[model samples]
Target chain A: MTTAAGSRTLAHPGLGEITLEGVLHAFADPMRMRVVRDLAREEGAELSCSYFALPVSKSTSTHHFRVLRENGVIRQIYRGTAKLSVLRRDDLDALFPGLLDTVLAAAARQAERRTAAGS
Target chain B: MTTAAGSRTLAHPGLGEITLEGVLHAFADPMRMRVVRDLAREEGAELSCSYFALPVSKSTSTHHFRVLRENGVIRQIYRGTAKLSVLRRDDLDALFPGLLDTVLAAAARQAERRTAAGS
Candidate 1:
């Protein structure tokens, strides 16, 4: 059957393992925080890991993405040679409603404030 | 002139150092999660660290409390012989909006589900 052939079924975290610590740690780094904010802004857009303008090495970038996936922050599905990253909004909402949005909005506002202060 | 004599003005982390990673790592442990949940429930109540029914030893317990305070999750003040712990709701709310309450409620719900399942 072609039912399972279309996509690589990624094992996103269930509600159990999505600890507050993991979520916070995942978004704590400035680079990871930007990745999360961009994902949130893009919503359902399937983003490639390379899309993020991170300052870290390729290995460090991989580590950050792994941390996010393991913590239920994002879902990743393999699409041929590239991996598609999407935020696990439903699971996160089921676990902590408004949390993802709140943090994202706060990050956006902080970014705006920083730009204003810098200029 | 007696200036700031009564209370030891604990130097809490300002908005800068309270990174998402530090906050999450602080509350990631199951014991620390419970402490945060209880603090949220109590609201403004000043809790003694010993109030928690944690499985860890006294010294380990001290470590957990230290992590919480250091991460800006809770504020600690020395009250004579005892150290008083209070959730930094204002700072958290200012930084991350409803993030604190959302996580606390989620934790409560998970605990409830666990109890129901165990029963």
Candidate 2:
């Protein structure tokens, strides 16, 4: 069913349908993990695809978003002419309880370590 | 590089060298995740490779174990004729705090939910 926001509808796995293996696999890729890290930092703010300045090509970015959406890590809905994405924090929190936060924190820690070492 | 336990040695990423992406990727596979879940439940108890009755062939099981070890999720060492595997709990806990526990708990919860639904 297409929402009023746009003509296209995205498929998202229900909270009950989300699996631990799916989530882990979705976040395994560096690009996908970066998308998740950004979403977590935004704290539930729904941002359009254009908001993420990923280094990859547009098609590659789309693939990454699709992976996240298919794995139930993020929910995507079209708003106006743009497709916005948001972390399924509520569903994930209910299902896994602190898993998202722990992973985000770990990613941040690792990034900080990399930055420090690089400097 | 050989120890008295056996004549062979395995390469494992050092604690500091382990990356968040690598850890997630290692746990992404169902077989690998099962191996990890079993290891976590044992709570630091080192078990030989033969202890795990994985449904896959010996080669596939070895590959999964290698992935886990190379990702720094588990430490493997030879003991006599058997190669024992143990979760690198201390290293993982130190690197990512409660990540391992949260994942393990999530897996357990999901398994319980599936069982309940199946019944």
Candidate 3:
């Protein structure tokens, strides 16, 4: 990435490199799904790793973000020691059409359903 | 009850019991995904376990199908000696709405893209 200059760059799958199974596996976990949902809320604005208050340990959290990046669901870059992440919305949409949005929306609905049931 | 009377029956998650992560995890595997795609092609008709010519062994195939059923992605029932399977499209659609169709369509597109690339 142009923004990845001068920092230890991370590897990500390009648009053509992403697969449906890989993306689904990355999203299958609750932690990774939370990161995706949070990034999607920003409307394309990149968010720092610290922005998401995950429930897991720091190392586990790192692993989650790495999975997301490696699966081509999100793009990660080191912006001066702050690893920022943003959903690869354009690429994912172009590759899978409505898959990402459908999953995200489904996730939101499930969250709401759980909350309602709990109440 | 009637169809399952004289044969072994399988338990499946009810509409309210299916979770987003559970469904995603079930769809994340290649073997289970193949079963899903095959079932989707049947247009809701229940196919027996042997209907899918999976490369995996019988036990492994059983495990995969069990994963799908437990996650609420598919329904399995035994008629005599054959365990028939079908996508829980109605239940899934009622709960997750367009999620199933979107994933299936994206998978079809991905398969076509891969075939074209290979050609």
Candidate 4:
């Protein structure tokens, strides 16, 4: 909620303003979905931007995080030099019950299937 | 599966090839989501494209339908002059478990919330 010096404040859409289309668009990208999956796995844990080991450029990962934050999928807060992100699970569940969990489950299933096929 | 004369065959990604990203992108558009929701509600009923009372132009509707079909969300078959579409519920359920149902439920909840808020 509060920002420290040199850390920019990020604008996030309120729960009321978060539309289904916006959330779907945010998760449509592979990178963004990966970030969401990781956040979901971490649950209550707040992760900094550098925590995610995404196979993309730093700017690209930043873009994906911004997309997720702007769409109200995650809440990003500045913590000194680190910008921490936490999944907006409560807001999303309240608005669209079972959606976030279902997406996470699907992602997990897909990942397992991919790993199995690869092995 | 079969196409009639003058009707072009639409290319659809097979169940094995359908990625979560593609399905999410297909449903990210409001019009396409509406189409999928309707298809889900009807279940086994196959309806023609003209059956959907969308607010968009004919071309735009066609494009949305194409996106859904190409992403493996729905199966569009040429039934004479009408291109009938049916939700690929089985394929999706097998691949992603409860994803389609969850999305439909979320859409319904959001619509109800919007209506209640408006009233």
| Model 3 TM-score (2 dp) | 0.94
Interface DockQ of each model:
0.48, 0.88, 0.83, 0.75
Worst 10 residues of 4 chain A by lDDT: A1-10
Which pairs clash in the backbone of model 4? none
Sorted by lDDT (best first), the order is 2, 3, 4, 1
* C-alpha positional error of residue A119 in candidate 3 after TM-score superposition, expressed in Å: 1.8
Segments of candidate 3 deviating more than 4 angstroms: A1-5, B1-7
Structure candidate 2, residue pairs in collision = none
Residue A50 miss distance in model 1 (angstroms): 1.5
Rank the models by DockQ, top first: 2, 3, 4, 1
| CAPRI quality of model 3 | high
TM-score of each: 0.83, 0.94, 0.94, 0.90
Relative to the true structure, candidate 2 reaches a TM of 0.94
Ordered by TM-score, highest first, the candidates read: 2, 3, 4, 1
Clashes of each: 2, 0, 0, 0
- TM-score of candidate 4 chain B vs. the reference: 0.91
lDDT of 1 by residue, B4-92 (tens): 65556677898766755577567667888889988888889998888886898999999898899888899998876678899999998
RMSD of each: 3.4, 2.4, 2.9, 3.3
lDDT tens per residue, model 3, A1-119: 67536558888887889999999999898888899999888889989988999988889889899889989998988878799899999999998889998999999999999899999
Residue by residue across B3-119, what tens digits does model 3's lDDT show? 646556667888898999999999988888888999998897989999999999999999998899999998888777788888999989988889999889888899999999999
